[model samples]
Target: MKNVVSYLFLLFILGACSSTKEKTGTSQAEAIEQQTIRKIDVHAHYRYARPYLSSFFQDWIMQAVLVDVAKEDSTGINRSWKQYVDMDIENPGVFYLCSSLVGVGIDDPDFATKNIERLKNEIATGAKMVKVWKNFGMVTKDGSGQFIQIDDARLQPVWDFLKENGIPVMAHIGEPVQAWRPLDNPMNPHYEYYKNNPQYHAFAHPEIPSYETIIAARDRWIAANPDLPILCAHMGSMSHNVDMVAERLDKYPNMMVEPAARFGDLASQNSDKVKAFFVKYQDRIMFGTDFGNYDPAVDWTAEQLDAEQKDLDATYNDLWRYLSTTDSLVIRKQHTRGLGLPREVLEKVYFQNASNFLGLE
Candidate 1:
């Protein structure tokens, strides 16, 4: 059984109503219908991180069975994802995955190839999207024990395989700037992992590449893999710069983005640029929550879990404000956060893009 809070959060996410709703010259129900679940959450994780041993979050490979949102059937995967987490389930769908072979000591080309084989078996079984987590930029290393990047040569074979299979990879690179800042949001409750894992807080070179440099590396990785339909997870992992993100989308036809767990500090700061990015490249962007059980670090301590909830609620509130509000403000470019977008655009972000990218229906 999952923890009480886990199930509770799931119920709230799926059951909680947005504080506001509107009809921009049409039926709201119709709008919801159009935007509903042709989508699959290409970036979600089915299992918890390494912290909680008995909790659902710790069941890395097959814990979806334990959630109210998870199902015995493949389609159940879609329903469970939304129903359990409180997303707009009207159009919940996507074959979510935790696609990272880099951390598995994938420095050897042979092992890399073999790992790809392992991944292929999973993909064969039903994995649609691949998730390259934040570890690459922060934790993962290579041969001779050095840090490997998102585009390390050793992992080329795996990249090639995904491209060949038409499986889109949701690559989440670079920690949020605050995640690195010792005093800022690192202590933010959602970041239970940082407390236990000292490695996350410690960086080899804080100022070496700079934030933009890491983004450049991320872009380079995408540019190098042209055939692979790649979704730059977390708004290309650069929520601070929407103009730059828009440029990336405009430049790369093969590329796309997901607005997962972002809309908070970003909307508060760059509302204008952010709005422009969403309105302009609306089709290229997908909606995501980055919601998963990152409870391992707090598994042994209830205090840590309590802290995480507060942070999560704050983040969720931001999403609600940004995505649901109809107010028109000018952060810089005169745009809106939750345009209550057209059904088509909503469908694109929530489902279609994921489907086309992953070759799912």
Candidate 2:
């Protein structure tokens, strides 16, 4: 009886050891998978720097480019620009800059020249790329009250300079096609935005340029600068359909795209189809979260900071899972299946492609 009891005790101890080993092995595997590849967010607008921000990037093995835009309200432009530049300086390899030209003087004869000088100065100060915002096609107007389209003849000099210097442009020229449709479907990723910002709701504002007009002008600008490299921010504003994006990608070999702030739209589509799209354009698609506005002056409590970190972790993890796994997941309150993309595709989409485009390789 004593011998049998001792043997039972030994079996229990061995079982416990096996379970512990299994758990540890699983954790180590997960850590290895998560940290194996480096990532770059090609589009972001981090206006201010915070002390805790570095940890987020380090934890994810990621870097980002802080994009600057010349908005109509210039009250905080200088301050914000300095903040971004300082952030890039502070975080040497972790942060980069993408500068933009002033849009307020598009009608002036010297607009292109002045912007060229500004861009040169910005490039000297460590700008890796230039950004042309939607203001060119949507907001900025000429002396005669006509909107200044992106393909305007006056801006040819600026494009020429970029092309000559081998600098890429990040063009965010138009709103999503859903902007032209009514806000009847809450499921649309852009429904809330158009509902809140009625000025940009093209269906309501027929006076503004139609969606087709803006997209055509953007295409013309792109085609005219065949030698120039252009990264279409926000899936070329064609997030509504992967087919449309593919068509553009096929048409313009000099162009690439980053799906900033449009992950929900991708998630809304059939997962298999989207996965195929990524596979087909694996070399051209890059990752961008559009995450920004890390101002520490808000006096956030420890609890708030903790909650914010949790949210950030979840966001990154969700995106990674969607791209790298085949698990069923809920994204933005919608049920969707993961892409289960191959490791090679993920590597290119997450880092390799962006590195090549930004010349960080």
Using lDDT as the measure, the top candidate is 2
lDDT per residue for candidate 1 within 1-361, as digits (tens), equals: 5699899998787554342233132246543453333434444443333323223222111112111121122232222323323321211231233344445456555777677886777565455666676667565555666556777777787888887777777777776554555644442432554566555554434533456556777888888988888778777766756766778887778788875655443554445555555667876876667655633353357677656654544443344345434445322232445444455565566656655665544
Backbone atom clashes (below 3 Å) for every candidate:
13, 0
In candidate 2, which residue pairs get closer than 3 Å at backbone N, Cα or C atoms, i.e. clash? none
Each candidate: what lDDT? 0.55, 0.84
Q: Model 2, residue 336: displacement in angstroms?
A: 1.4
User: TM-score for model 1?
Assistant: 0.64
Can you tell me which runs of candidate 2 are displaced by over 4 Å?
Answer: 1-31, 74-79
RMSD of 2: 6.1
What is every candidate's alpha-carbon RMSD to the true fold?
11.0, 6.1
